[model samples]
Target: MTDTDWGELAQHWLDRLADCSVPGAGVTRLPFTPEHRRALGVLTELMEEAGLVVRLDAAGTLIGRLGGPESAPALLMGSHQDSVREGGAYDGIMGVVLPVLALMKLRHDEVTLPFAVEVLAFADEEGVRFPSALMGPRALAGTFDMATLDLHDSDGITLRRAMEEFGLNPDSLPDLKRNPTQVLGWVEIHLEQGPVLESAGLNIGIVTGICGIERHMVTLTGKAAHAGTVPMHLRNDALAGAAELTLATETLAHETDGLLATVGALHVRPGVVNAVPGEVSLTLEIRALNDALRECAGAAITHTARDIATRRGLSLDIARTYAQGATTCSSKSIEHLCKAVATGSRSEVRRLVSGATHDTSAMAELCSVGMVFTACRDGISHHPSELVSEKAMTAGIQTLEQYLIQLQ
Candidate 1:
């Protein structure tokens, strides 16, 4: 296929994948759902059309393999197929499609390599369905915690039960761990999910690393009282304290370099407008490529929240819900990806740290990992407005194919 055709195919497949979502504004193909099953069917057909042997692993990772020689350590490339709640079409799915198209182009050309190639469609990365995300990569890396199987989702379904319902034996998860020595490194093609590339007028970039993430689940306690009867000064309002903390976090992020602080979720109790909100629950998320910076920002947010609660006569309860340390990409992999992009674009490839976590972070534990990023519109992602142009995708496929050829 020509470059233009590759781009067209990437976009077409993305549109089809988007349709395998809940009837909503954006894609919502969570792991183990009917939509996920439908998407698997579509992907399986495409993988087979590219002349690959396919299988869904015990961890629910859909893999497509192109054989090389006997006992050869295969070069793995892929991304997750799952989407966040109402997330954009390209966020996770594009990573899976771009590599498939690259392999298709290679197969069309009848190019043979010394090393086997495998494209992986990881089942979960967004942690939307279950709090314990990155199941597929971690399981493959042999880092999966069996205890997480008991974790429940919104509908009270355990992770183990979900896997069982999906026709996967939960007992087989441990056996799915791969031998790192027999495996080549992992390369993930993903959207930049930021404005750096677009601002720099570049179509592609290389990832330096995945940022560390920490989430704070906070609750402020105050007395619930009648909104009309209680005077503003006398009422201990938890929502007011939460509002103050939110602004404080925003200011901290703005002031600190390399720090990203967001109060993405907030819930007010006794939700009725007429009732003075006596209790509030909120989530404070902190991220940074530097672990020290992330920790410092998180500490600052905690201090700020505590102060807000104390000054407002409200009690504060804070718990750490999630913590993932930063992960640097393989230096060799970055050089290889950059060389390919530089060859394709006839210019330098931009390099940036991914503020958002990815399956690559989990995959890194299994093997050396690298990532190539395509530009997204206005640096938006995980939203309905997120977009990547066909031209950009075409460039992405070409880059991946060249990288594969060069790797061989």
Candidate 2:
């Protein structure tokens, strides 16, 4: 197959997986769900068609392997199969589909690399159903905590129970851990998910590092009162306090360079038209390429929320739900990615930090990791409108093909 054929194949698979979503809505393939299972089955078939041997690890991560020398460690590629609720088509899926296309092209050309190539469709990278992200990569890295198995979802279904219902054995997760020496390196091709590349009028770029992320669940408590009876000055409104904190968080993130803060989920108790809110619960997240910057921003947000609650005659509480450190790509891997981009396009290779987290952030713990970024339409993702041009997709596939061939 030619380079154009690879791009067409990538688009074909993307369109296929997209059919699993609700009509007019974005993709919603959460881990272990029926849609997710169907997507995996389709992907497995594609892997087999591409001349790769496919299997599932204990965590349900799909692995499609292309053989190489027996003595060399394998090179890992691909990304997660699952996505956040209403996520765009290209977020995680592009990383998986593009590499598989590249592998298929290599097979068509009768070329084999020095190290084995394994295309991985990680089970849960969005963590929408679970409290933690990187479940599959964490398992491969041997960093998954057994206690997390007891964690419950909104429906009160424990992780272990959900796995069992899905026909997986949680007890066997430990046995699937990959030795550090078993992987030569890992490479992922993902959409920029931001406008950096598009703004620069570039088709592809190299990732410098992934930002640190911190998540929190915050609550404000106040006395409930009749909306009509209570004067605005006399009301102790938890929702009001929460609103002020949310704006404060936005301001803090804006003032700090490269910092991103979002209050995505909010809940108000006694959600009635005539009742003053007695309690408010919200989720806050902070992302920064620097650990110190991330921590400082998080602390400032918490402090501002506390002050708002106190002045509003409400009580405040904050619970940290998740934390992951910033990760830099290996220097050698970056060099290879740069060379790969140079071979595929005339565009200058650029480097930028990713504000969004990826499974590669966790895989960095297991082996050397690198990332290639294709430009999205408007740096828009996690929404139905997310898009990348065919030109960009072609550039990405060509770059990936060059990178894998060079590794041989």
Candidate 3:
């Protein structure tokens, strides 16, 4: 038995964390800012109350460590502390609080974990202020690119300078790389950020893997002509080509087994009522749990777009902008989580793949990674309306604590 006032504690802690944000409608805690510092203060209190030793890593990742038996590797938990501007209260921070509360519940029940546990509040995950993200997890995984330190924020502050001002030694970030041998695994509990779980009438779901993502910047060029003077046959409109390509991408996704493609942004040149569009640019993104599937679709869409351009007498340029391979949750981790789910819920664990990225993807480079997706209201996220019920929070805490107890 435990004294768990789930809604009260979580809601109160979330309120306190929300208050640490800048003056805004939703929480606006960016890394290395006053809001981040204030929220860390609150987390420190929670960590201390849970009987853990707290410290901040060189990259500003706030870590709370709970020791295990001698020579045991640590099981890393928690999520990012920062948020997008006017973002939801529970996006990243809830993952941090729920784990600490799980530890607190274990302590209250006199339950001790067999392996070392660490609650990590990563400094930046949203990349809202900077052009790069996943600094903490990537550093720990030894996959961090040192050149990113030179990247500048909106205010012209270099990441290196911001780290220095935040009392962190940027030079030591590489030194903070976690040894694979010293880490048991990593688990992140976060809002579903999608409607899958909510639509299923479930509060929690186990992640099968994180989708691989790729983006291409596409440009189409054609001659601009007077709309009234040039007939449709004579006009080589770039916007028309772009429209065809967008539909092609959509059709490709719809026909494919697992691919999800989008023309998320588009721009037209020579804005005028009379002039024909001269040029067009857009972003084409494809995501899938299978890298082969994603890459295949990307190739197909690119080829189709090029053909469309040639037929219309338009020139096209497509450049790959970003690519991250898909990451699958370890079978061992899935087995353990299944057992944990049996401990708390009657229904079988619902397994799903995440279309969006998370810190778990980066941590996979260091050790095995798993995720628990807590359903949010109407699957809304990255906005102020994000909501996770206290009942769901309590269920998550129970399962996480059981996970610690059930780990082999």
Ranking by TM-score: 3, 1, 2
* Steric clashes per prediction: 0, 1, 0
Looking at model 1, residue 128 earns an lDDT score of: 89
- lDDT measured at residue 189 in model 2 versus the true structure, 0 to 100: 89
Q: Candidate 1 regions off by >4 Å?
A: 222-237, 269-277
Q: How well does each candidate superpose onto the true structure, as a TM-score?
A: 0.91, 0.88, 0.98
* Alpha-carbon shift of residue 77 in model 1 (angstroms): 0.9
For model 3, the run of ten residues with the poorest summed lDDT: 1-10
| Candidate 3: residue 292 Cα off by (Å) | 0.7
Q: Write the per-residue lDDT of candidate 2 for residues 80-178, one digit (tens) a residue.
A: 988778888888988988888888777777777888889999988888998867888989888989998998889999989888888899999988788
Candidate 2 wrongly placed segments (more than 4 Å): 21-24, 151-158, 165-167, 222-240, 269-279, 309-313
Distance from true position, residue 312, model 1, in Å? 4.1
Candidate 3 lDDT over 182-252, as tens digits, reads 89999999999999888998878888899999999999999999999999999999999999999988888
At residue 317, candidate 1 shows an lDDT of 98
Give the winner by TM-score: 2 or 3: 3
